[model samples]
Target: MSIEKIVDQALQDGYLTPSMEAEVGRICNTASELSIEEYMALDRLMGALLTGEVVVLPRKQFINVMEELVLSEAISQAVEIDKDGDQSLDVGDIAAYALNRLPPLYATTEEGAQYQRSRAKEELQSLIASQVKEAIARNLDRAAQNQTVLGQISDTPLLEQMNILLKAYAADYEPDDESEPSTPN
Candidate 1:
């Protein structure tokens, strides 16, 4: 099945959350075929789904931060307006002043949506690149741990032991610096 179909199915089955579905869509829409980074991103995303390791930010905290920023801007603008003269605004005057300075709140235009999708895809790829590095590091750590345990079990040459330990993760291993950055294709 296509990635979009898979994501939709996962979402409907409660295996993936809406935010994750959005990220998957971002990945799929950015390219006709997955790049190495995209593949790793999808891998991490699915792993999160299967392992229930999804990290969701609290909605209330996001709302509070947004509200704080908006209010701060409004107050700043109100102060500027009041400073024009030695005038003190009553509650209603301040409210009206703040409201007038606020930008229109409405649905995004198609151009805006396109820009947002592009930005999201870039951010997702960047996040996935870091995740891939971390995954590689973890695998290396596990391999080292296994090597230490197995070394105590036998007198295997260290080179042979290291080879065996790393073989699992070496098949597709490429240093991040050696790979081209993921771009839409």
Candidate 2:
């Protein structure tokens, strides 16, 4: 059976929910067609998943991927003419290096492909930022609820209380701070 079908069957049998199966399939497909770098990323992702650390999932993988990308680029840049007078590191060779280095089964649309070609890392960064933001929002909501019930803080003070909690969160964690910087120095 196709991998998609396998996932579908898992859902019908109550082994996996629709969302769980989708996440599994998405990661599986990406890992399956991966390049050397992408393979490393996916493995790191799996390690995080196995440990119940969703925040660290793609992040660990990204660190590996970025390292590989830098190392490979450096190696390619260092290539020079050999004794036989042949220039090293041709485009076809680099293309092959890249072909095996990205996740498999990326969604396709002319626009999406163009976006991928133009700013691939941008998309990944956006996804990571979105997830981080979602987690923060969820935690903030939960904290607000708890503070209201336990501390007897008024609902009118929710915004202020959330900010205080968020400040504490920022102190403890390196939040995904991708927001635009201030204009003044």
Candidate 3:
């Protein structure tokens, strides 16, 4: 029997656990630092997986990190598309960037081409959603932290009021009693 058949049988028999899958994914991640071209190739491979033409069970973490890397690079490219020092991208800019960055799918029929275009746009939109949410969350967290630090350091009336309120609040909570006179007596 061929090695492929043996591996297939092993997988079918539930011999491949999550740990093994994670280890394989980690190894792949370490070995291949995927560039834009490689990202496109991986997307094509994902098409096969989506269509059930190929069966792959990569670790969730690995898939997430891979998608993050691709999306980060794509976003970076999109942001850099306009060098006007605007520092932000509009929806049309992002849409155009996605269209340009993604690989073209050539189909013989118009319907097939339209289907491929829709699929590509849908996938890119999903990527945008995940990446944009994460970016917004990180930025908001950082902003909140900076605001607190600034309030504490700046000599402003608001900081003074906050400090007074904090001290009052702290005064309300007494330390635990440390008396041991009864035991000693």
Candidate 4:
């Protein structure tokens, strides 16, 4: 059902009173007042929905709440323990852990939850850096188009900077991790 429909049903059932409804509406809007803590709360909430995390926002509150409120969050926390028994806490690991620990309003399983964040893990593990360099190689063609635009319009400062940045990036860019390219390629 649509969110407004759900809201109406909630109001009719006395779950969301008029005042509470308005407050929730504002929360749904993602007003600037949502603190960093609240941002984390919502991310956890919505993520629960994905990994079977939070069920209240249930199947759809995900889009509803995020539309109004920007679904921003802390820059993730990480924990690094190499095979040698050294441990460190970084941002992505922290975020993932927090997501895993979300209360039942979100989901039912942690394994599922972890998979839901595979992209974050991919980024955290630096797996994407290999792909990033290759993508840059392919998209470098567009740099010329972007350069054309920059040179055209009264020289927008950011565009000019972007041109310089892309050229420099293409020149000295080194991927932190480079996967062995497939022989077929």
Candidate 5:
């Protein structure tokens, strides 16, 4: 959504949600330059925040119990794998990959989080382990593929690179006459 829309929503709701804040941050970070209206909208949001008109929700108020479970599983598996000194896996990547495949267990209170943890352990431990293993395998495969691809790219000639790119992106691409330098009239 546009910054204006987000700001308007916040004003109307009297609270800025974490997702909304993240969206605003993402938009600002990705944009090369903000329009005047965008800046004005941000200014308005800031004013609202300062004046207690729009309360910014605290990020610490919520937790995803699944993330913790995934991290724990990933770390234990990673430690054993790393013992060989052959493969170095990214625990975070494995955790994230597993998390994507697993169901989210979000909680707003300590009691809720504890309950979710117990439920996950009882019903999802095996699934979580299997997903983590799959994530690790995929990560390893991708790493090997990337290394091979990078090696091939470094060895390829510049003309060959251009040809490969053209074939992939524009199989029928042709140079336009207008693109060429023209003689002075």
Candidate 6:
């Protein structure tokens, strides 16, 4: 949302959501110059915030316990793999992949989060390890595929590279000898 709209919403709702605040920051950062209206809106928001008219919501009011578990597992596995001189694994990617496969355990209180963490450790530890291992395997496979594609492209003639790309991407592409290739209309 635009800064003006976000500011107006905050004024009306008496609260500024974290997402709205982030959007405003993103706009201001990307724009070369803010318009007079945007500046005025920002000024209004600042005044509202300072005067306690609008409260900014906390960015993270809850925790996902599963995310923490997956991240810890991924980090340990990544460290071991790194020590072996294997391809460097992206811990974030591994965690994300494992998290997507695992059931989320969300908690708003520390006691609840602790309970969830213990429950996951007791029941889902093996599953978490397996998923992280799968993610690492997939990452390695993708890296190998990318390496093969890059090897094909490097130090090759431009036309050969184009042909390689076309063959890799297009199922029924055929180069015509008599005329230049025609694009499908």
User: lDDT of all predictions, in order shown?
Assistant: 0.50, 0.46, 0.50, 0.41, 0.90, 0.91
TM-score of each: 0.21, 0.20, 0.25, 0.22, 0.56, 0.59
Residue pairs that clash (backbone atoms under 3 angstroms), model 1? none
- Going through the candidates in order, what is the number of backbone clashes in each? 0, 2, 0, 27, 0, 0
lDDT of 6 by residue, 6-77 (tens): 999999999999899889989999999999999999999999999999999997779999999999999998
lDDT (0-100) at residue 43 of candidate 6?
Answer: 98
Clashing pairs in 6: none
Q: Which stretches of candidate 4 lie over 4 Å from their true place?
A: 1-8, 17-110, 116-138, 148-185
Leading candidate by TM-score: 6
lDDT of 3: 0.50
Candidate 5, 100: how far from true, in Å?
0.9
- Cα lDDT tens digits, model 4, 1-185, are 33344444543453434453455567668665756665564454445446542223223222222111111232211111233333332433333333333322222355544544553444433423333333333343455556665566564687677767676547666556556465674
CA RMSD, predictions in order: 25.5, 23.3, 15.8, 19.0, 7.9, 5.7
User: Per-residue error at 90 for model 2, in Å?
Assistant: 47
Model 1: per-residue lDDT, tens digit, 80-156? 64677553434334333333443323224556545544554455434333433343344446656666656664677
Off by over 4 Å in 6: 1-60, 162-185
Candidate 4 to truth, TM: 0.22
TM-score of 1: 0.21
**1 versus 2: better TM-score goes to:** 1
Q: Give me the overall lDDT of model 1.
A: 0.50
Candidate with the larger lDDT of 1 and 4: 1
